[model samples]
Target: MLSTSMTSAVIPIRTVYGEASTGTSSQPMNGTVVHEQQVRTARSYQAALSDWKRWAADHAYALHTIQPEAWSSNGGSIAHDKFSDLDMLIPLLADKRIVYLGENSHGVAEFNLVKTRLIQYMHQTLGFNIVAFESGLGDAALAQGQIKMTATQETMMRSIFGVWWTKETKPLFEYMKETHKSESPLRLTGFDIQVQSPLFQNANWIPSNGLKDRALQAEQEVHKWRMSKDLSGFRKAKRELIKVYEELLQVVTKNENALKMDYPDEPHIVKLMKRALEDRIRVIQEFNELCIQSNILTEQEDYSASQSMMEWRDRAMASNLAWLATEIYPEENIIVWGHNGHISKAQSLISTMPKSMGELMSKELQQESYVMGLFMGEGQAAENTREPVQLDPIIPGSMEDILSAAGQPYTFMDLRYRENERGNSWIFERMIASYQVMMPMSLELRRHFDGVLLIKQVKMPTYLPHKVTKQIG
Candidate 1:
């Protein structure tokens, strides 16, 4: 059962066939009818647990009861909540390079406990430093042989992102600040990579260590590609441009493999290798296109735009390498954080990270350095999702199939707050209204680092209301 604190007071209603439901009432409602229509828009959710159940059966996963960490007045510690996903994610977190916290998944209380406890385990039990996050000032502290993180600094970053910090995040941030204070904290540094490229700068875009710019680069690249006349020319120039990426992947893979051989039980080491390989391939592909489309790489004349792009890439890559190379402390443990797209997926700085910063450090960086990505809600929440898809824990099924199984009405009635659209519980109200109708599968992806947790959410629900009804004879 879903947590009650997460429940909404307003009941969302669906009009099955009544006059008021279908907008044929004697006195048509102002917007209640619209809300009702939204409530009846979809069906129910189920589980296709055959494969997962088999895996669970094969493994010796203790069914640890997961519940929200009910805090005591003293604030020292308390019992952990039993979560269905805990057993699934623990093995992955045993020994890994990166822990991905999928979008918004960790943001919630239940998921946050899984993530924070894993970090604690990594730091306290295993001798691992360098905790990373989806946000942060990267590599700057790495070069200084220290990570400087303060609770105040975190509050500032939270303000930047407009994310309201909860009691759950407090301990995690506190741990990070106290543990890595000597070392530079893995600040959530959201920089626009495209603007660092001269091309975007020339077009009036200034690069900032801001999420807005980092988020905007893909579209910018696409736009530049679309506007260019000879994309092939750019591709040709970029054919050899991804050499740095290939080298980074090769080195990380070899080093990670060596670490695995030394400690085969280190699951985090193995997982990092797999993630890095994927990231390397992606960067090479994207960079190749950028080089070819710009044609600036092979231009007979100096193309400032191409230079600017290259410079931007160089700077970002340099910063990442500098951190990875110089930041490791034999006496202290550190963890870094960055977005899933930057740390988990194939196109990030880790797999295809450049060597300049390593050179800057002079002492060759070891493969023992672990890198992981944290995910929030689902893996794809950061991606474009304009349409509805049944991609969650609930299995794919029709409306009647779900409602019949839940033994609940295929419809709900819209009641409280029908007059106010932007009520305090609007989003929740909307979700309740939407979920009652469109039961979706809750499929999620997760990766764990050496006792660190990372999860990605998929098939998330939004504001769009879906209506589902049984095609009864």
Candidate 2:
């Protein structure tokens, strides 16, 4: 269980523009003090805005405006003209083997559509064949198999996508199905951690009676130990569960011949069983590690532990992506989709954090990886409470502010060679602002991404499917 108490000393308050108070001082005459205080506050606001405006004007050349019609036909299927804005980005995409499309959140419909169109363009023109998402690796693999087997789109959406199940994402799933008809079909993969879901237990590969019962029993035992406040006992039970899963994996692998003989009519059952067992083993291993961290770390160290877990998850994603690129599709280009934070190439806000997936892959792949960060200047953003809130205007001295000042409805700026060629300055190093999980965060732009895609306005994703609601319930 997590702590519910607030640990920080500071109180959070909203800042209202032009609401600064003039200070009252007893040392001086009241009229003089009030006049001087008001002058100081007014000067401060004006100076900050002026400084930001100067920076924006100086760096305006670094940005390239992107028209909405460049990527989408609005509703048509015709090819984009050579003069379209995507023409400016085609060379950039062509130079990289992997492209990371980072979103601010999972609920922005316009951003999702932009990504979908990009994926379609890459698939149709550039021949990028694999699309990897930040979802559970095991669950996505299972869902892909189901999709290939003609499963309902609703089932695939519910089983694999989690919060990314809005109607804006429907085209992605439809594309995957349509691509399956080609000689060289497109692939969808998940590269996140093994988040254990109930869907995995009913994957048609696990035996309905005995094996499923044993697996559930092991999980229950671990949960029982966890809730009892017996850390050592929990660790012990978790390790035992790990062994059970490992043994089950070995059994499935070693007896493939005999298993095939027993289930003669369903030869693919053995492979599915192997996948299921492997997924179980990975989940148990992750669970045990979490238990160990919980036992060793104190309550104050909870945040540190969380950062460690986040790094661990990103490393796992990078490793899985490497596996897919090398072992699964050696000749194919890969595209990754996820939030800006996880896909950033720069260090996160936490100082001790390790490289994110994008950073790690960029280092390994060098020029083969390209990362793009997306931003919205103002719009409605979805929250976890199933409500949408209006986004406050971009903050002064932030990247979004600079972009908004450019007066472009959409823009794409290449950051890879800007600092080296255009001279390193404060504008190149300023932190970019974004909202994550409904909270605002600022990150360095040039260090984290190679390019940015900015949309002047956005709207909440309203086309969430019934399956998503049902699954959440």
Candidate 3:
């Protein structure tokens, strides 16, 4: 990270289909020029895509050899050196403090493999040791606290969503185990506020139950609001929760040493105590946003996963990420794993929805953070344990089509730009970049992500077998 550039060990024999390394723009990409870019995106689409193949041939980073590792019999890596194709991105992302590696969904097989490779690169080369996942913050923290350094599969699965425990990601788990024995260690944590169970309310962590009693009553009130939207009751509960939380935070800040005596055997006792408190606060903050959402959508008969609900969740996530970056690991660099929708600076096509987490972080962290969105041309898509669906061919002029035309199985492009010069319309034009619903984000394509990594074709993730999951849990 100290330097922006690193030469790839194996460069392509010839630059085929935009396989050459090229910089798109010198000016920094930010919100200041979003309105201007949106106007530029209105340029003739046909003109932009006519030379798509030429642009792709000249700009795409062709990558077909970057595959997942092959494991040996004794938990050793039989896999060779890899991801040289990614060296081109070193300069674009090296200076970033927090890099969000995001997926269109939780289901792509190849996405996991490539992400693991990226994680390794970040850890070994860029000095990023912490990875904050979109999982339960308290659950992951408490699970990791029990381990000395390396974590077991079950412990990890228990903490995060099932999307991460796939066969493709098993190597990452093993890598964590291996690195723990060395001078460099890749530590895993979660930034999400939601937890499987209520945290820090038991007698083990808190000597007195005054805070716990107040928290339980607040929880009950929340449940009541869920069953029946009693806004007044919920308001009372939220106020009480905030009051009690402030008191607990004050005590922890004032007397962390005195509290540590209660957890004599715990290794990360201090972090555990503070993280548990943070978890509760996140839940409260989430509910606080939800209150706004409830005002908007609760009156409707069918309020199932409304856009407003998603907006509130994104707001909560942004808040948690800010806490993680500024408070939890101020000096250490971190990588974030989550969905493309959460990490993109692009606004939702529906103007009414709240701003996304990526947009918020873009404003908060500015150039210090980088977001890269993953997409594919043709592929099988699935959620965890669900049947895979064959993806329709790429839309004629979509970003995927242009990239796949590079004739390579994988390609990458940085969307940052100087000005909307002609022939690069595809980069600036209002086009769908993903295979899913292709909801228009109103902004120019370049604003959606700092850069994009393309997979020509992909298969659905190989979900971990039930027995494997059971054992891990």
Candidate 4:
């Protein structure tokens, strides 16, 4: 018989959430500090089920995935097939106003498996709707707006189109187009940029009209920078050049009045001007340093750099949020797919504003709809071989290690490393390069959503030792 003390031993449910604050009690792992919300005791996995049920009911959402924290090489036997992917969450999410799909980490094949499954669910089960990516922001803007692409924007779009239309990303668009035509007619949005040739060509030449000679001279200074025989260095030069041109153009573009400008503003304007000038000088000095980081840049002088991509990401997020504010319906089901970084709470666009244009429009249009983020698991064993963690702090051992330590029984899965040179080459080095692109999208999830469901997995090896530590004196 179990003793009363043994039965009553408390197991604290420790939760680390993004919203927790730092510099306070019970600091959250993600830099936020939060007090322990509650304490509970459970005798078995079955008892813990009640806690999850209660959590789901209170939050109006269901989280379906085995926690890595639950896996212990010493604690018990773990099975390879123990975890559930998005397919398990689909039915639960059927009634949701919005479903956020965050990809697994870079170089993790399991994420692609999850993504494929989600796409299938969206097609066969959910039907068509808007499909957002971590990439494709510029093209999305062009598709939505009636205004002709500015020379700069057009170049940016073409560059992006060239990069993403390749083998790796082509299927995502094909899937979107096919599904859109059949079901809901999807819209595309992204927060990525193209950083290569043809698109970055000197297409935006200032007209040699009398007042713009300085602009032409600046462009020439940037062009001569190409002789360094390094594409990455030249990209820095181009970004600097573009910044200078934009500042110079701003002066010519906007007519100023003295009254609206504070006399103190003159000093501010001077500072701004000096900053722009100095930026170009800094770019020249840092050109050599930039070249060393160029392995990610294409061998061909064809691709663009992260600066333009980051700029485009901001514009895309702004535009998409604006569109959502108007067109999205309250209580209607919506699903958004993007990279892990883009949907995180800290940098996401949605979290930054309480009432975005999309939120306002959503309120006026949809009623009381909600948004949420799906934080995908990355850098864990089940995700990426390129990056791996030996232990989980909360659990204190590997999936195998924990089971061994605890003298528990478990099964393990066979995880194989598969690499597609054509398919995955660009994902880390080039694709999803800008953290700015990922941040805002994730923020919106944390801010606008009623609750979040994080998706992660653990891959257990097939072999395990019968004993972890033999106490041989």
The local lDDT score (0 to 100) that residue 410 gets in candidate 1 is: 14
Ranking by TM-score: 3, 2, 4, 1
- For candidate 3, the per-residue lDDT at 365 reads 85
TM-score of 3: 0.73
> Where is model 2 more than 4 Å wrong at Cα?
1-83, 199-208, 216-230, 251-282, 286-288, 291-302, 348-354, 419-427, 435-442, 463-473
**Ranking 1 against 4 by TM-score, winner:** 4
TM-score of each: 0.35, 0.72, 0.73, 0.37
Candidate with best lDDT: 3
> Which number leads on TM-score?
3
Better of 3 and 4 by TM-score: 3
Better of 3 and 4 by lDDT: 3
Model 4 segments beyond 4 Å from truth? 1-98, 139-174, 177-187, 192-320, 323-334, 339-341, 344-473
Clashing pairs in 3: 4-91, 17-56, 17-57, 18-56, 18-57, 18-58, 18-59, 18-60, 154-472
lDDT (10s digit) by residue, model 4, range 328-441: 322234555554344433332422222222233333322323233333322243212232433232221111211122221211111112132221211112111112211212
RMSD of 1: 20.0
Q: 2 or 3: which has the higher TM-score? A: 3
Candidate 2 lDDT, 1-473, residue by residue in tens? 10113211111222213336666554556545433344233334344445555655555433233222232323223264533446556777887788889887666777777787777777766778788887766556556655656544653563455556666776677766666666545567676655434433543344445765676677555444433445556656667677766766766676667655543323244654465456556645664455446546645565565566567667767777776677666678988888887788775643566567776663567468888888887788675344687777655445666566666676666777564322223335445356353344445567778888777788887555443221110
- Tell me the tens digit of each residue's lDDT in model 1 across 1-473: 23233332322322222113243234356744423232233221112222223322232223232223333333223333423324354343445343333322322343444446555555444444454432222112211121232244333333112121344445554555444333323322221122121111111112233422432444244335433546665466333434533443455455654544433322344333333333333444564355444464446564544543443444454454344324333334444433323332212222233222112222233233333322222223211222333323322122112222322211111121123322212112212211111222121111111112222233332321222111000
lDDT of each: 0.32, 0.60, 0.63, 0.34
